[model samples]
Target: MHGRIKGEAAFRRYVARASDELRQANYTVSAVDLIVTPTRTVEEVILSTDGPKGRVDLPIAIVTDRGPGGLVEIRMYFSTWPITGEHAIRPPLLQHDPNVHEKGAVGDYQRALAAGDLAATLAAFEPQATVREPAGGEYTHTGTAELTELYTLFFSNGGGIPLEHCTVPDDGRACALEYNVTQWGRAAMPPEAGVAVYVRGASGKLIAARIYDDSNPPLHRPDPSFAGCVL
Candidate 1:
């Protein structure tokens, strides 16, 4: 808890405070992600903290409860379990096909991803939109809250994941894009190739997305989509 727990702003303040405190204590913190949903708040911070003993790598997950007023409580979960996952993340191995025209929304996504513009990237999605990552997994992301978590974690660790398209389907209702994502730092896995499907809503904004890629379970496959995707 940071403040009187007023609203989302207060919640964000708490997050900033947490990061600040960690840094001030000679602990270098790299945030993995932060999720502030209607009922829950979770933050994943990777810390390299030093003390009398020495320096150690710590993957820290901080969780908190959320209420109408704001954040409620906090806790931390740690594990000796190592972080491992394979992904085909790199600068687009192949160039974007000159002949293929890209969709506006999809194109915006690609540019935002390259620029590491997290907020701009998120603004492309509808509030209740759903997203599936580049690698097929047991989990799917739905709504703004989940999306926030997905991107937050990604931009924190994933760095600038550039995508060079090999294909962009002509179909307006459904478009599939083949891409290569960039691997996160220090926590590197195998390279990954991904396909993302982008579908438009009646209002013409992206409403749903699904991804298919070679990323393994341990690596966090945040966003990569457009082929073999279902609406």
Candidate 2:
């Protein structure tokens, strides 16, 4: 879905237009990955799905923009996922997260997590909100500064890892996210599943986020430095 309108208005319009058709198809959209400019202006849109058209809610990496700028257009994809050869992955999508109780909140939260974008990720939380780890308190943060530090480490060292998240707990603020962490320094990491609860504040910004995951001995990286890391 592409719109030339300015800012969030354009995004709202895009969602409005897409919701009806998606609902009828029995496809629950937990989130959409959008590409906005450095100015924080949304310029690109991608929706992945499998339906009447060739639109792909393409499994993992749904939509990508090849911007030269003309009119805004939304491209849908079908059968997008891990490694597929000739066989096309199509509808009656059996595996999908139905935890989209709050569309906007869940969408922003999950998208930011997938993109590994720090600002967007933090923006989803409330300033005084706490982020708990399934591991322990030693790996938790509540304040903005602390959360920022925690995420800085996460984004730097914990990227390029494939993650799939969907709404859970019956369309509430909770999301069931599954991913793989390769290393925790010398320790071996395994495939993990976790629930991330995001709640909004008075201003509608994410007020708090609590994460619970299964990663063996937890993600206490020995060298949690952001030296050469890039977001």
Candidate 3:
């Protein structure tokens, strides 16, 4: 149920196994939005059926790349917290309404995040905005207070977080970015694969930023406790 699968037969078995497991668990999956480019497609989906405890909402993004022959690659981005309901207490990001797509707002957010400007970043969000850390629900940051704390720690390295954007697909409600983490502040690192979704609100501010990545931060100014924070 983890890592990459090779070969068409192995991939088929993997899909079958996943289908069987989801069906056995009584989970229902649905697509929230889809965006297709010339050579790639991104589908935002939600799995909010049944889990070990009860109904849990898990938002995911599936990215597919097209080759000359057919589909060349598929990557799914999500955390397993909703599936296991482990240390999760926050509400779902896509419970009632999906995020609205505002490219302007998304662009502002990207600038602020890339520059590591905490104030600018906060200004790009609504008053009650939330940021779900890549780790899981337990690390969700809501409101200005929590978000301030989170971003302050984030920019402690004295510079911005650099990303090598691969593909960005946007429907009307959300923009999913496929990226590779190349640097954090002044430190350079090996390319680490990751994906993040920026959800815009009616006011043209970001309501949520959901990250699905496992990149380790190279902290120049480390905090003793940030709840096992990562990119």
Candidate 4:
């Protein structure tokens, strides 16, 4: 039979250390309670906490094996609860890379236009991409080569593409960017026009893109003149 003992000293020490670690890692811990089993082999810890989005209830258990020397293993479980308060939830440390990717994509597009880097701009787009313009028709292109040709003509005729904002979906599968363009030509252009571009990617490479603009229904115009155009 295994001997049971209440080792309060050891349990308190472990809880203090764990709490400090969690705080250092930027996790908000509140209302913590710790209890050590009479046998001193199991410790239960509970706390109210919040994550990047909302509040949660976290319960952790530390188990010590029966032995002459003190050895411990800890396990943590998290559950969310409805709480009303202003709490800033912390983001996961391991998710920095994906967050960086999203920022990079937005920055790339902005830089491309500011520097007039056409090649770099196109490089940011997927192979099979579709572009919709406010007064212009939709153009679907299959590859980089075709897209470049279209961009070349558009820029040659004195066109300006300006991005306003982008939204990354929570699922991380797609992004929608809002932009405007001004074309200087004999034809009169609207004072303000916008385009919403929806993009899907895999492994950081764009695989599909579709654009929504004023030319189609939201507007009373459906110019089909630019059909078969790529870019």
Name the top TM-score candidate.
3
Give Cα-based local distance difference scores for all models: 0.54, 0.43, 0.69, 0.39
TM-score of each candidate? 0.49, 0.43, 0.70, 0.39
Ranking of all predicted structures according to lDDT, beginning with the best and ending with the worst: 3, 1, 2, 4
Q: List, residue by residue over 44-123, the lDDT tens digit for candidate 4.
A: 33444445555444433233333345553332222111122111221121111223223444457545643446787677
- Tens digit per residue, CA lDDT, model 2, 130-181: 6654322244567889978877666554542224343233123333222233
- lDDT (Cα, tens digit) per residue for candidate 3, span 1-231: 246767899899999998887888788778766777778788767776676677777767778889889998788776555564232222122212123322787777767877999899899899998888654446788999999988887878788785656567776567777766666877776556667877888897888877876555666666444332223
Candidate number with the higher TM-score (3 or 4): 3
Q: Which residue runs does candidate 1 get wrong by more than 4 Å?
A: 1-101, 134-137, 182-191, 216-231
Preferred candidate (TM-score higher): 1 or 4: 1
**Backbone Cα, N, C clashes tallied per candidate:** 16, 19, 1, 0
